[model samples]
Target: MPSTNCTTIYKLVQRAEDDDIEDVGNQLFGDGSSTMSVLEKKKRFEELYGVVRPDAIHAHPPNVVKCKGSGSRLPSKVEAAKKAAVKPPRRCGKCHKMVNHDSRNCDKERSKKQK
Candidate 1:
């Protein structure tokens, strides 16, 4: 007679094999229907499970803190200031050129140095 653990493992293996066979069948017969194509079934699978397997990874809220009793922390004041201080890449309106600053502050020599 087989042990309980052995029987459990055998059942798991059997279920996995059955799933594999069904997957192969789906690929060959397009989910047991001739109307739907293999590509459609693949697209459906991707839409259901974004990138990771639903069974393998547990879903969690993005803002949830892992540490006990501690709430989600905000960015430091310095970090926030640094982010705010960052300017978008400026383009010269007159010459229609990409430069460090707008047309009013465009430095022709400095632009040459960049190249």
Candidate 2:
């Protein structure tokens, strides 16, 4: 056999390994092996399949507080405490008297004028 240099043997082994890898890749993926890189493959895939956009599934409505009338402003801590201390009597709409139950479910005797 002719004398071969170590560099020549190394080059041959490297070429054989590369060819084996290419052959296995060609077997796995189809034989139309383009010279495109990984990034190029990703770009082509994006161009063909398009990108997916995520949907807002957990979206929520904005919280809003509305103020109406002259005394609709938020009360202070001291004013709230005083209002809580002096609990006003609830008046019934039907009987027009201070009662524990509301007008909707009042058991008071109706007057002749109301009837």
What TM-score would each prediction reach against the true structure?
0.28, 0.25
Clashes of each: 0, 0
Please give the range of 10 consecutive residues that has the lowest summed lDDT in model 2: 104-113
Cα lDDT listed for each candidate: 0.71, 0.68
Q: Give candidate 1's whole-model lDDT.
A: 0.71
Candidate 2, residue 53: Cα displacement in angstroms equals 33
Scanning candidate 1 in windows of ten residues, the lowest lDDT window is 47-56
Candidate 2, after superposition: displacement of residue 6 in Å? 0.9
Candidate 1 clash pair list: none
Clashing pairs in 2: none
Q: Give stretches of model 1 more than 4 Å off.
A: 35-115
